[model samples]
Target chain A: MEKIPSSEITPESVYLSRRRFVGSLGALAASALLPSGLRAADRFEELRKELTPLKSITSYNNFYEFSTQKEAVAGLSQGFRTSPWTVKVSGHVRNPATLDIDDLRKKFPQEERIYRLRCVEGWSMVIPWMGFPLASLLKIVEPTEKAKFVRFETLLDTKQMPGQGASWYSWPYVEGLRLDEAMNDLAILATGLYGNPLPPQNGAPIRLVVPWKYGFKSIKSIVKIELVGSMPISLWMRAAPNEYGFYANVNPAVDHPRWSQSSERRIGEFFRRKTLPFNGYSEQVAHLYAGMDLRRNY
Target chain B: MVWLKRAGLPILAHAGALTPLALLIWNFFHDQLTANPIQYITFRTGKTALVLLVLALACTPLNVLFGLKQAVALRKPFGLYAFLYAALHFVTFVGLDYQFDPELLKEAIFKKRYALVGFAAFLALLPLAVTSTRGWMRRLGKNWKRLHRLVYLAALLAVVHFVWLVKSDVREPLAYGAGVIVLLALRLKSVRRASAKLREKLVGKQGECRQVAVHEDLR
Candidate 1:
């Protein structure tokens, strides 16, 4: 049970508040002034007193488009081109225009939201993501009456991302959210993390951040947003339909074949913590599935 | 050359098996084990155990298919190394990862099918590991060979455990499964006889090896 030093524990918030809190206060003063993120209702305050280091958050990743190996992703995705990127908002939308990455940033105000990302592989991380709500972005591109689902596609450059063309999964990784789920406040299109514009590994320019679902639903380096009439099958669903479903919402009771969702190992924590339903965002997002059966959905 | 075959080969085998473990320890001390160190260690050890198990299983097949008698000499050491790593894998799971929590351990063993099969594989290997010594081999006599047949079941279970573990992309595990299958297939009496006959008809026909490798009595 080796402990990370207390000094390194509260290191990210100051350096992370890059754009908004620029030169406002000293690092020490800012840490004191800054609100310790959404841990008020968190019962394990004593257990997880500090945030996961920005180094760990950046280094340990599940960017399969870069590599299957988690640690190798950061290094492999080094040369991935992000700038001059255009995210095409197409499919069943009123204003189906391909917006430039920079102009899109200007259009939407980015705010930092610290969310606990529970991976389907039983590992979890608390990431301070800088982005605007997906609802905000969705409002700009008004969905037509036929738009029942929102499908996202990651960048498909095999040249930039070495693992893109891998046969293990279909190319240009696709994830879908119901129209209501897409409009959820908790769901955001993340552009940056740890007070910095995303490095190539962490989805670079823009990626989805659906906090309540398994991390895979948060597709990275999104190149296309298709508002579809039918429920779009995600890449995981195509790969293993039985194991991975369309709605990959984090549920403790739903026991996966490989790893149990009942408990998860928070990256920094040594002991396994009991996983929460909807990843503890039940109050925020649970009402979306009021009458539906979660087990079948899972 | 005989001395090299007798001593040097065993030493090389021992070194080859132990080096990854040494490197893992070195990485742990150097802070190079990435973010989730426990997971890194678990993956490394489990992979090593699987590889060593595959290598151990391949030894007899190598002898049967090609009459490489020296492969037999390496089997016990490789099997023992695989057992050591399997034990370490379990210890890491129960102790470091789960923190010896009884409830968590029970749930992991019972609820997770992969864990159950992997644990069963470990249990199968335990008796073989305990009776691996010459004294125990002498005491067990003919039953030693019969008891050690559990290695095949252990290997199969390990493959099943691996196959079930992945969410998608059965490619990597399937590659390992193919390797295990080939090695296991080579062990079959009919497959061995056919392969030996094929080799004899090709290259071994001209040589002094007319007796088509009935060498591995365990086969």
Candidate 2:
């Protein structure tokens, strides 16, 4: 599944290219990451070695109703809408694209990368997400200088999503990141998890996965990608400004007004443990915020 | 000592019976329970409170139906349990759910209908608890009986609160509501019967006095 990289690729072709790239690179990365002793698809098992535990299970949720508990998302999201899905890439892009789900899957070469997911509520989860770097997808969109940030929009219909109908939370979630953050190598366009297609609750079809930021920053069930010169509005931050901030980085020192961010409860941890800063990935992302005060930013 | 035998031991026993509750709390703090333990804690406390409340209400019937002289002992403990769980329920909703934001609390009460009913129910429970102590009961005397009557009101409000708190698929709340209605109806019927008998005695005494006065004037 060799993807022909081109400058003027059609949205349809770009979509197809992404899926091919994902499937191929995923295999390639597996072989690269694993020792030769392991066989084909055997690398997923090695990748599973890095299939780490979350810093906190409570925060690692998609808010899907199937499971009343946090760990229930895996079981509940099995029925997530995957096929016939489409992501419309519009607003400030050089070329407006309406990419079909099948084509997008074929276009991207998947790679399994382990990352930590820190929630705004002082909890964290670590997962081995399967997809290519978001940089690859952004490369196809080719944002102009005016594209200061990338905004993501989730599907909002309450008829399909019962959570939206209830007062549990607001629906049609929106999340965004600065252009630089969106293009970071850590940023991922996830299509699958734990060596399978993405669960419906985990932003099935295609979703942005920003590891360095809070879990909400990685929106699920994306239907629109907007590149804007202006700072795009974020839903959670707007909902409660003091509790939620625009830059939801994982910093143990900066406590939320309600709870201490210094510690978290891992899902299977017999004892709740003190939280690690940057969810134990400080080596990767601490440099990005080296000079800035996370407390103020938080 | 006599009062202790009558009232204080039951209260002490009720308070001591919180051992399981203490264990649950210990389980949560020690991390023996699941993460996001607040939801579990909240639900467990609520269910326990509900059961105790039903038991508290049933004490009167037990005194009448089964002739259990010690049924009064259950009232204080069960009432206190209901109060404890109600407090926990509110704490979970405010602490875990809203993160102690007064603004969010205000918004929920103002914008959300369920929140409004829930808040009202919480307020109703406050007076009933404050008037629960024997000291307060003694201090108020007759006023105490009038104030403690708030329990019935509080019970009605709680049922309403639960019923409205559920948006749809309300079979559970409806059952609770029906139970509350029947219990309250029994009390209402008994009160009406007593008042009717008292009115008849007063009227008959007045009629005899009038007849005697006429007989004296004719003689």
Candidate 3:
């Protein structure tokens, strides 16, 4: 638990770091309204920019530990051990990297970009994600052509995450995406949000942020990354394939086995809003699904 | 007769059964439904309903095995409340999640095996609730007993419904199954005792029962 300096919290540091992030794309905010603690980015901002046009900037999340309540995640994740963490990158890449947490954060510059994260269960949260592009990390791994998809696995140890001990969700969190989807600029390997290290419940150290797909696809607290040629086995999909599809694209037209997908409740908003195609990042990821009927694929 | 008074105690038990429903509604109105209100409400209501249904089904064995005659009268209200929550669960799934999409609803029921089983359990409980009133029970007469047997079936369906819906874990359904088996065992024991008592009463004048003669020899 090393203490971050008070001066390191300023917006200029965050903005300067963000500006130098992967050739800049989105707008820089006034920075005055944002709290000092909410200004810096980690190493995944470049990838997050392409997933902009976020619906709301404060609500989407996957923390279920202290409470399933979205507001409780930040408070609950304080108990996490973020240091001495390592991400094991395995499978079809030429160089298998097992990088230390701090080393991973220092590898790339940071940026502050807002992106909408729509959950598979029909809820949305817009987050001012602070990190560099995931594609940059993928570049480092040097994925071979044989790799067709990238799968992510969360730490299943209930000792670390109390929520895993409960029967609430099929615990050890797992999610994945196709190779092209993984390499898509909209995809990010996030480590921080609002200028601070990602709260534990929100996937501290590092996690996948696949903006166009459902939130679950963005596996949190990732300890393993595998590149495979076949469709990766997803926990939820294997549990109930009809309810949670393998593709799991954010499509309004597709209805879940037991629920409708036409509309979604933005986490902070009072009312529900119509769900957008690719969660409103159609311009970026929609082409990836071209020639394929979303409803059928859904 | 003391037996008559004891039999009437079931009426008292019926009043007691309403306490849980009252507390549940009170908790909901008071905003004690947890942080994620939707999940909290859904889980609480569904769980309470399942508990009540199990209790209602337990009445027969409880009355015969434990002589909990008063518990028998609680069946109707408990059964109806189970239906109420089951209906509420369905509505929340449809209203809050689906927003009244008929095509989606139909497809969800037909396409997904678990959803279909859950929906069927809901449908089975509906008839028991509709005929729960004294007037309907009287009008239906003995047919009411036959129709109410659907509860046992409903209990089985409910357990299956939960089992199918669960992705991997079997713990919850296993608990429910154990409860159902214990209750059914009590019912079986009661039924066997009643038949034995009838045989003894009918043969009392003869005093020549074969088992009795064997017991006398052993003594």
What tens digits encode model 2's per-residue C-alpha lDDT throughout B109-204? 665565566667667667778888988878887787676566676676777666654433356777876776665664554543454355446666
Instruction: Supply DockQ values for each candidate.
Output: 0.60, 0.07, 0.13
Candidate 1 lDDT, A28-144, residue by residue in tens: 354355442333222223224356788998898899888888999999988778888999999999989898999888999887777889999988988878888898878889999
Summarize candidate 3's per-residue lDDT along A1-298 as a digit string, tens digits: 9988987776887778766662233224523454322332322343354342332222324565344545455566677887778888889999999988788889887766667778876667667676777778878998998988888888776775666666746656667788888877767888887777776767887888877788877887788888888887777776677678778888888776544477776653434678888887775677788898777676
All candidates in order of DockQ, best leading: 1, 3, 2
Instruction: Report residue B183 deviation for candidate 2 (angstroms).
Output: 16
Lowest summed lDDT over 10 consecutive residues: which window, candidate 2 chain B?
B210-219
RMSD of each: 8.0, 14.3, 9.8
lDDT of 2 by residue, A1-298 (tens): 9787876556997787885676566556754665432332333343355444433332346464333345566555656666788999877777779999778878988877666666665445557778877777778888987898898888876656665654534456788888887876678888887768776766777788877677778888889998888777677766566667777887666755444465554444323356677665454456667788788877
**Shift in Å, residue B197, candidate 2:** 16
Per-residue lDDT of model 1, residues B1-219, tens digit only: 888868887899999999989999999999989889987898888889999999999888777666677888999999999999999988988788878888777878888899899999999999999999999999988999999999988888888888888767678788888998888777777886677667777775652253343443663
Per-residue CA lDDT of candidate 3, range B1-219, in tens?
A: 887687566655555556666776898798554334565456556666778789888765554434444665666667887888788788876676556667656767776666777777888898888989889989998888888888877888878877765545668787997898776664564554564465467656442353244233212
For candidate 2, the C-alpha RMSD (Å) to the true structure equals 14.3
Alpha-carbon interface RMSD for all candidates, in angstroms: 1.6, 9.8, 5.4
lDDT of each: 0.84, 0.66, 0.69
Give DockQ: model 1.
0.60
